[model samples]
Target: MKLKSGLMGTIAALVMGLGAAQAEGVKVGMITTLSGGGAGLGVDTRDGFLLALKQAGDAGSTVDLVIEDDQQKPDIAVQIADKMIQSDKVDMLTGIVWSNLAMAVVPSATAQGKFYLSTNAAPSQLAGAGCNARYFSVSYQNDNLHEAAGAYAKGAGIGKVFIMAPNYPAGQDSLAGFKRFYDGALAGEVYTQLGQTDYAAEIAQIRASGAEAVFFFLPGGMGIAFMKQYAASGVGIPLIGPAFSLSQDILPAVGDSALGIKNTSSWSPDLHNAANKAFVAGFQAEYGRLPSLYAAQAYDTANLLLSAMAKSDVADADAFRAALAAADFASVRGKFRFGPNQHPVQDIYVREVVKVDGVLTNAIVGTAMTDRADAYADQCKM
Candidate 1:
């Protein structure tokens, strides 16, 4: 009888160990701006996630990361998010680079009790009244980066600056953000059609307006087409914009035209940090190009999630959420933390576009915005 009882105890212990092992492997669902015109953003997001996983290096953790593409379409993003969450039964969901897409997926996914960690796309609604307890933004609010641009341009003594962006929801938010921080006279605010190809009328308007500087928030192909045409249009007004337009992707195509442009970006390949330097070098070596701000943001977001996972009891969703809320790790941007609304409170750097060794890149010229959060946080009742 004693022998039989001992054997039963051993078998029970083995079963418990197996259960614990299965629970330890983390599962993540990542969806991003893939396919269509903005697929580059997805490539960067996926690469960053994988690179971060490699860096964790035997933190005694395993991850099953399921990735999908949004194709830059709201309907596709919704379908992908629903499928990943339902079919994969993922522990967490992350990485939506577009605000419109995020707006679609967050409510549905968060309602299902899945923790939604947004690596990009900071819709204003999420930060304010529409905030969700299960939804956390790993990146800053949409306005935060644009406000940085405005702050930098204002400090540069840029007077009568012309601003332009696609007349989409996020684009309007970007313009409003810049205008908030820029206490300068407006040359004009031009709302071009979302994907307008021609900048001839805009260029003529800018020339006539005589703005000393130009600020814009055009991402993806919109930015590429605008910059190429802006340069071809002979509009040379000390152009400034967010890092998306001045990104490595668009910069290479624009060539020397990107030079002498001043801008503010959420992330840069040239941040003076060991991790950032390594990330820049390694990503460039592998991909044969410098990492864009999108890449940097996604990379940092992955590390932040990993850091939280490393410190938390993964099986305990509340504990994991708490760890992420605290934000204990140093990001590629040096230091960052979460506001009460779960948006990043981090520094924004003022960078200048220049050709270095025949490569178009931005140099961290100075610090413009530091440890900044969105102005909408005050409205967040969460």
Candidate 2:
């Protein structure tokens, strides 16, 4: 579905209205993991953000976006956040691909009174007691998709399941979220080292556990490595996971090994919405590749900021915050709204990896949950 001409006219009017004020343009700082293991995710996210800005027509006139590579290191992310705030004097900060980096950078930036709009990464702490008024996540909470996977497993009557994840905060959350809804016997649960490529040891355990299915949350190269090894191991158990493990950016690298795998996610390239159709077509035309959930969420983040900026000046923090909370923007995802914790409340779907015109990608199979809010929202006072 394309944006209606009326909506396009509205956006044009908003852009034209920006010229009425003599205020300084908004400055935004983005620190994302652009190198190392999961660089593809960050690259897609960056490209999506830029694509949205480009579509806005002369976005540089109203927004100054400064991007930095975190290199998948929390320390580097912290350093970049400091520079963006102290040197660049950015009014807002966004774009972090990993939960660990978000943990290190988001709180401090928000505490310092800078509005932090997270394109990705939804650490549990930020959605609960650590929630801040200045922070907003355009993506699902880290565990939401995992929880949907759990629900899917239950519905599919998978009575015995083995789960694995990288040993980190987000990893732990993945297991917890899965167990919360998966009312079945756990064959086993294991945590591998973060960024560990070899999974022979884990495969041995899975092979012997008599598991009916397997769920894992390894992203980037780790996922590619694990799937390749699993396929080679000839384990007949069906694989299930969150979208991160089999994202479009990583699916091509995984090849047919990832085909027929089922995963849960809040967005898909084929979502039957006007905004999504436009985004997917525009993304392919611009990058010569299909856009992943990471790219779609980042694209939505840019539109969110632009929508808020159209309604309220960034210099007016309270007004801007209120405007954003209103969520007066068209999301590529058909249904999107922010919960009390500033995280999305949307539908999560079960998707199967399939070839569309011989290109490996995900196809929506069924709805796992609808209008789901994060589990930790009640813990948030704001």
Candidate 2 stretches greater than 4 Å from native: 1-23, 59-61
For model 1, how does the per-residue alpha-carbon lDDT over 1-382 read when each residue is reduced to its tens digit? 8558657856875877844523355678888876766777778877876777776777524777888887878898898877887777787788887788888888899888888888778889888988877788877888877898899888878889899987766787899999999999999999987656678888888888889988888787778888888878876787888887787767877778788787887677777888888788877777787888777777787787777777775667788889889888768877778898888888888888988888889988888787898888888886
Model 2 gets an lDDT of 0.90
In candidate 2, what are the lDDT values of residues 2-50, reduced to their tens digit?
A: 3485477558768878465434568899898788888988998899898
Q: Quick one: best lDDT, which candidate? A: 2
Instruction: State TM-scores per candidate.
Output: 0.91, 0.93
Q: Report model 1's TM-score to 2 decimal places.
A: 0.91
- Candidate 2's TM-score reads 0.93
